[model samples]
Target: MKDNAKISSAVIKRLPRYRRYLSDLQKKNVDRISSNELSNLIGYTASQIRQDLNNFGGFGQQGYGYNIQSLYNEISSILGLDKDYKMVIVGTGNLGQAIANYTHYYKSGFMVSAMFDVNPKLIGLRINDIEVLDYERLEEFMQDNSVDIGIVCTNKDSAQEVVDKLCAGGVRGIWNFAPTDLQLPEGVALENVHLSDSLHSLAYYINRNSQMKDQD
Candidate 1:
């Protein structure tokens, strides 16, 4: 077993990509994979893969390569996906509803166990078979359901308040969609997804490609 806290954040970030690629290889009946093969498949250098694996102790054979199932299990356990994570969504707006309905999230190890909203009309509504409970009942719901993660899709102004309530209610992880900076307490993990930043970057790439074509 490895200490997840001790692992570099960069390595931790790449674990999900590695897991997905390995899963694809398994589906293709790949029994063994070399670091070079993984590197090519994932677009990472061979040496980087070896170094990442070395951090968790070498699992690959000297010449034979790594067993697909063994490597998958090792990575899965390291990333804490071996066990299912129960999550709740805070906010029942368009983005929140879409996230609740996203089938791919369920295919992974995360489960959207519940949803919360401040709107009285939206409360008690069902989205994708998950009941939308009142945000006022967040503490009770969290205690009753033992939610491990929270998806914050509230407006920028209320996002911090919602996070504060979530923290007080015992959430360890938060997937935030608000475009505001959040001040999180210690031991709580906050992952922000900035839609505006992504769109801006996409526009930059489009312009860059156009300039490249003009040069050609």
Candidate 2:
């Protein structure tokens, strides 16, 4: 650990992109890649890649560049993917069920062992081959199963309560998909997924490009 306490959030945020791109390269049989090559593939400048990787000790060689598999493993280890993580979803709605069905997360070392819902119909149902449990048992389930991450797919109204219960049950990470902001404790890692915000940015860029074209 290279004193991650000092690493900027922006740098930390790019690790997943690096891992995903490296996996893509591996699938294409790319063995080694220089920073400039990687930059072209991922749209990040070579200097940006160097700086981001340098935060955790760069893996690039002086002239040999980087070995794709080795670099992927390095980034995976940094992202805590070397160890299997048990996950539980707090809601079994469409969003929650979609997340449960997302198999790529499993390939990335996260296992969705269980799901929860308050609706009587959703409870006891199986999604993605995992049995849905009653939300009432969430706290006990967490205590017994050693959940590493809690995926909060609840509505915005219930998001905080879900997070509180999950954290209280010893979950160290929360991937919140609700449409609101949340506050986490000192050591807990929080990844807030605001879907509409990205769409809003897309619309803004489209409008801006249209205006630029009008001027041209």
Candidate 3:
């Protein structure tokens, strides 16, 4: 792999999509693929694919293209999907429960070890066999368990506080579903999944396409 710091975020973001397509190809028993062939399937230009991949040591050969399974495995390793991550979810609300269920079904290395919530009704409730513990016990749980990631499903008001506690407790990363942005101390990674922003972007494209159709 090349120097990670020098790689553009755009290239990094495209890695997962590349891996997904490669996975699909592998399921179909594809042994290798040329850049042009992969670009047709993934919608990226062949040159773009080659350039983006070149940032990560150029997995493709000049004429042999790329080994399908090898590239898939390499990209997965690059994205850190090869390792296991034990996570704790803060806030056992509807979204939190949905995430817990989704993670339970996902056959990946990510596992939700525990969940926390402030609601009395939700506390002690089990989702996918993972019990929701009281928020007050979060600190104690953190001290006792080795958590690799923290999932913030709380409201904007409580998100930062939950993140602070998670960071203090030594979680290496945070997957924030909160509507607001959060600050993190150096060395702790953060990935924000703002559903509203995505919905708004969808709305924009929908309206834009409708207007274009009307113009015709």
Candidate 4:
């Protein structure tokens, strides 16, 4: 096992991308891949890919490059994707619902164990076969369940508060969907996803292309 303290978070994040590409290569029966090939597929420079991979240890040879199967197993184990992770989601809104309906999580080694909300009407309802529990029961539920991660889909105004509660409830990792930047205490891992920002960027690109066509 690699020392968690020694590995940089940036390298940890890139491990997933590496795993996905390696998995794709595995499906195609690709026996080996060079760092340059990985760089081209993932949009990183060849030197950058080599540096990231070398940080963990030299997995590739000087001329033969990396064995696809060996690299896939290595990255998967490093990222903790070799084992199943228990996860829960807070908030039962549209975004939360969409996530609940997503089947890809199971395929990726994460299982959504529970869903939560403060709404009386939503509590006890089922989303993707997981019962929607009242937020008041969060702490108790965490005690009974082996939840390793929490996903926060609450609004921006309530995001920080929800995160605080989750932390207090013993959640060490969080996937925050709310727009607000959260201040977390030490030993907690928080990943923020800004959907609106991605949409805005997409819109900007489309508008820029349209304007260029109009000029031409």
Candidate 5:
């Protein structure tokens, strides 16, 4: 595989979509696929798909195209989905609990090892058998467990503090769902899901489409 840092973020972002399509193809027992066939399924031009995949190396043959299972496995490995990751969630509110349940039911390689919350009623509860401990115990828990990811679902005011504690405890990555932006030290990976921003983007597209129709 080529150096990931040398690859553009746009290409990297598209990898998950490629993997998803490949996984669906695998479910249908499609053994081989030409770039053109994959393009039709994924809505990317064949040339674009070929170029994006070439960053990781030549995955498809000239005429034989790609072996579906092999390509699927390779993409899974590339996305680091082949490995198991243990995570802890800070905040046991609706969103946090929903994420916990979703990962537990659907994501086989990711485990929610613990949950923390400031609410006493929420504390001591178990979601999918993972106990919700006190927020105050978070630093201590982090000191003991080898957590790979920290999920922040708290309010924006508390998100940074929770993330700081998680980072101090040695989490290598953070999945942030708080509404505000956060800063992390060098080396720790951060992924943010800003719900309001996404909704705003959707509204912008909706308004643009309405205006275009009006013009017509």
Candidate 6:
């Protein structure tokens, strides 16, 4: 197995794509898949596929390609899908509700245990079977429950306050979906998810491609 030090983040990021496609293959009852076959589905070259997995260790056989189930398990284990993670969303706004409703991550090790919101209407309501607890009780609720990750889906005005409370409550990992850039203490893992930023990135590439075509 490849240690964290020896692996590249790009390789780690692609591991999810591998696991996702492998999972699809499992559902189709496909037992084994050659590198070229897998490459066609995932849009990666066969050699690139082999190189990526080689970073982690032996996965493919000489003549046979790879056992679909075995490769899925290996990639899943590498991505820490073998463990359980509890998450709490600190807002019940549109984005938070959408995430709670749409994401099936709960079925795959990362379960969203609770949701919090300041709006009186949203508090005590259930979205996607998970009850929205009042923000007033956040500290008490956190003290009683085990939250491994905190999702900040609040507005810019209230996002930092919610994050600070999560930090004070000893929560380690945070997924911020707010517009504000959050500052967290050292040792706390933070992932700032700016949907607008991603859209802008897409716009940039699209605009660039259009300009190139015009010049051509």
Instruction: Go through the candidates in order and give each one's C-alpha lDDT.
Output: 0.87, 0.90, 0.95, 0.86, 0.94, 0.89
Rank by lDDT (best first)? 3, 5, 2, 6, 1, 4
- Give candidate 5 regions above 4 Å deviation: none
Of the two candidates 3 and 4, the one with more favorable lDDT, higher being better, is 3
Candidate 2 residue pairs in backbone clash:
none
Write the number of the candidate with greater TM-score, choosing between 2 and 3.
3
For model 2, how does the per-residue alpha-carbon lDDT over 9-39 read when each residue is reduced to its tens digit?
9998899998999999999999999999999
- Of candidate 6, the 10-residue stretch with the lowest lDDT total is 101-110
Worst 10 residues of 3 by lDDT: 54-63
lDDT of 3 at 11: 94
* Each model's total of backbone clashes: 0, 0, 0, 0, 0, 0
Per-residue CA lDDT of model 4 for 136-216, tens digit only, reads 888888878777788999989998988887887788799999988998889988888999998999999999999999999
The C-alpha TM-scores of every prediction are 0.92, 0.94, 0.98, 0.87, 0.98, 0.90
Q: Write the per-residue lDDT of candidate 3 for residues 17-73, one digit (tens) a residue.
A: 999999999999999999999989999999999999888787988889999999999
Number of the top candidate by lDDT?
Answer: 3
Write one digit per residue (lDDT tens) for candidate 6, span 104-177. Answer: 44476778888999899999899778899989989998888888899999989998999988988878899999
TM-score of 6: 0.90
Q: Tell me the spans in candidate 6 whose CA falls farther than 4 Å from its real position.
A: 104-106
Candidate no. 3 TM-score: 0.98
Alpha-carbon shift of residue 30 in model 1 (angstroms) = 1.0
